[model samples]
Target chain A: MKKENISDAVIRRLPRYYRHLNELCSRGVVRISSHSLGQEMSITASQIRQDFSCFGEFGQQGYGYNVEELKAEIGHILGVDNDHHLIMIGVGNLGHALLQNFPFSQCGFTVDAAFDVSPAVIGTAVNGVPICSMSELDTFIQSHSVDVVVLTIPQTVAQDTADHLISLGVKGFWNFTNIELSSQVPDVQFENIHFADSLLTLSYRIANR
Target chain B: MKKENISDAVIRRLPRYYRHLNELCSRGVVRISSHSLGQEMSITASQIRQDFSCFGEFGQQGYGYNVEELKAEIGHILGVDNDHHLIMIGVGNLGHALLQNFPFSQCGFTVDAAFDVSPAVIGTAVNGVPICSMSELDTFIQSHSVDVVVLTIPQTVAQDTADHLISLGVKGFWNFTNIELSSQVPDVQFENIHFADSLLTLSYRIANR
Candidate 1:
């Protein structure tokens, strides 16, 4: 199926499917029926079938799905097989946290370098990746083929920074800036990190409960 | 409207509506048509109308929605009007980033205090909130009315920490532990923050493009 035809709801659920399948595979789960998979994920068995049907079939009538094979299939569809090159802009606390904590390489993204304007942080290194100055961003982008950029910059300069990166041939962005940069440039691919939205949803549950 | 009936899709969209309406209200855009709102958000106007309908009426036909009024309505529906007290566990890199950067007070959750195990960090102040020892968590929770707990702890100790807090009377959690804790406790509430999912989505976009 083409990307345009897939609903946002389906696209969003893709990662979860990939993650669940990965867990099952790691734990030596040979196979999983939609009903049991649904139980693990808290989704309905029919809904699980429907979500997977949007992509393609990986199961039979009563045979269920092979955990490793299904995971590999979903991984291919989600592009988890691609070794994406990433550069983090703004090496603040959040940047450091991501650099130190996130298993980017294991997940198929290699964070080659990080950039920042802070003099104290510019020369510093985290996880053996050199932190470059803001002035070197254009050079860095030119020298290395950067696929995705992680924006940890302040909101004031977020869009401008993104525009600069896009102009410099960056393909996509993993934005953490509080602003809505995705909407500004429709042609550019963006995955906005909106933490507050989750917090608000949690609040809604609390209030509703 | 009841919680169970409302689809997760619609509940997730409420934040976007709240955020967009907030921006519109801030920009002095008093009124907005569904069509314009849809265009701005990259959603269908009918979808926007349908999502809003899940809550309550905040607009009139042809007249459009009052941005400020609608924002306030959504804010209330999202429990943004309620003051939520938050206690952050593990004042590490991610924790510090959140405390220093995120606008918790502005978003209805006030981060009253933080906790850490390290001697170097304990008793330190981040954004005026004191970081106490992890041993004091029970006492702190007992003394204060903490509605939400921010778990920035390691995955190994995450569930145990959550269980400890729940026994201490905490109602909810905003989890970034990289492990699923919400499903373990069926009756409890949580919003898991997964940054890796966004990276995977970005990878998909890059590969597909």
Candidate 2:
């Protein structure tokens, strides 16, 4: 399967397809045509075929696609089977919430530990994930093969924290800090989540509508 | 301003521009050239100029852009001046975290109330925003100007909850449920936050690298 030359738009759509297929699998749906899947996802059938074709054909012309097989294939392409190790940088409100609720394991990642500056939460745990002091972060990352660092710290310290983590061999970042983190190091992936952006986008739609 | 023909890509960049301009304003930077701004944002100078052109001319030909003025103009275009009224549905971990930390007021939104089915939190408040029973939702929305609903509910009830909120006159949604909400009502806007998609994107990069 050719992964190179795939558009970012198609890569972004893979998770949506993975999610929708998960729902279909749970409901005992075995197979679906591009037209039926398109209707369910609100995407065009031809567009679905085109996207799937980017990763090699997962469907036959007449027999459609096997739901479970397609989901597993997409999951593999998304690296869900790799079991990436993750750590949270700030055990703040958002970080605490994510630790409590986010299905990280289901998405092929594990929270090895969390680090925070606050003394009150230093030894405590959220959803069984221990909150360690910031001083222990370097040692923890060195000992553990930490792949992604979840940044839920204040924007003022976000970049510095990320830089420090990157130096400790962290390869990816799931950033919740309002500020964007641009790593000077190559091969470091940053997925910055700007809640305000989503809010502003919604506001724009509401205002225009 | 010609808002009609503005592409979604440009709309998405408005918030980033707003954020960077804000950083500049806080630092007392008075003006910037499109080339410098583009460098800061990693976007091209011509692209920045073209995006701003979709709205209107907010810069001088040679003097560049007045930092505060351009930020304010972009803010206005993103409806940050509208003072949108917002409420949170499902006071779960994610919703609780948002209410406690999200800078809603900075983006021209006010959280009026939060709703949950749990009796333990029904009369409580997070960051002074009262948490009411879900039963009171209809009456509260009936009496107040609810512009948006923040959904952090379970995916199982996400669609029904959104439908009910839409029926009660909510025009916007900042949806955090794992499921996507497609409102049958016209003019309703949904900004679905899929954390898994972001995570998967990161994982893809890691695996491919």
Candidate 3:
């Protein structure tokens, strides 16, 4: 779809829009005006209209938007409708918790395998996803088509692990190592999740308030 | 500290700067120029200078910024030096993992307690933090000076739970409930963590690339 001039900010908002639409769909809401949707999401109606215009028109002048239709469109833009094979590195407390709790399938990601350096968790399984040893990672990636690698590994090894994964043809990364991972490879994409950053932001707000 | 007119974007970047400066301090790098810092962070040197100027004069014309001083100043701005007593709600897998793994004390947040509705985990503890029954939440908050509440609860009850906690005078929230928790209370601040958004962003880049 027309993604040429779309900003990263707009791309990030697509998921939020998709999520709201999913909620509306579940509630059996068929349609919504930009004004009402914007009010609920704390966004401006004009901004909402402008963001949607980057992809394509989903609403008429007075008819508003079809909830399911808008949701499907945004989901399509987010590539959430595509089947993605994902693997997790570092089956630590955080990794194990994610494997057990996160609804990865809802966003079209399936955790086919999880790799860990620990012998204790290597043969174990969390929610049917097998936890394999680090030694088998190369062979598994060679045999399986892994589209995304979840890096819950330590900060020291996160970059090296990501580089190795990139060499193995993995292009997407969901990194939780707190260190920002940047690759020299052009096609490699990383989304770093820093819990400390979020907490510090909250603390800043509280302190400033 | 001159906090007025500081934009949210600038506020968000404070933690990142704090983290980088922290690494520099640990590595015995006493000083750094904004150009070098900006290059490493992928931010413009002018933007870095502008963001730091919002707090105060951090670096001299040619002397550059003292690593320890900048880190401490940013930490103070982010309230990392304050002793914040944080209590976590919902001692599920995610909560358990966070309690076990997250270095909250580094950011001046201590997980004094965790609450769970489930009787199975009510009396247990994760990483020395006691898991209390949800029934005791009110009493616990009444007695303890809790500055922040970590919501790891289900989406269905997230808003209601936040409202209840707001009524109890808690103002800061680190929410992992997937749902956006908004409060009518003027002082309450929420930091929502959406793993799906990050994952979807990664997926979108992968698909679009």
Regions more than 4 Å wrong, model 3: A117-120, B62-64, B117-124
Error of 1 at A199 (Å): 0.2
lDDT for each residue of candidate 3 in B139-190, tens digit (9 for 90 to 100): 9999999999999988889999999999999999999988878887898898
Candidate 2 stretches with Cα past 4 Å from truth are A5-7, A27-50, A62-65, A117-124, B5-7, B27-36, B44-50, B57-66, B118-122
User: DockQ for the candidate 2 complex?
Assistant: 0.64
Q: Lowest summed lDDT over 10 consecutive residues: which window, candidate 2 chain B?
A: B1-10
What is the per-residue lDDT of model 3 for residues A1-209, given as tens digits with 9 covering 90 to 100?
A: 85786777788888889888988899899999999999988789999999999988899899999998899899988888899999999988788779877999999988899999899998989999999999999999999999998998888998899889999888889989888788888888888988998899998888888
Candidate achieving the largest DockQ: 1
How would you encode candidate 2's per-residue C-alpha lDDT over A55-130 as one tens digit per residue? 8879987999999999999999999998999999888778877998799999999998999999999999999999
Clashing pairs in model 2, backbone N/Cα/C closer than 3 A: none
The alpha-carbon deviation from the true structure for residue A55 of candidate 3, after best TM-score superposition, in angstroms, is 2.6
List TM-scores for all candidates, in order: 0.95, 0.87, 0.89
Fnat of all models, as shown? 0.81, 0.78, 0.81
Total clashing pairs in model 1: 0
Residue-wise C-alpha lDDT for candidate 2, range B99-200, written one tens digit per residue: 987899988999999999999999998999999999999999999999999998888999998888888888889989877678667888888888888899
User: What's the i-RMS for candidate 3 in angstroms?
Assistant: 1.5
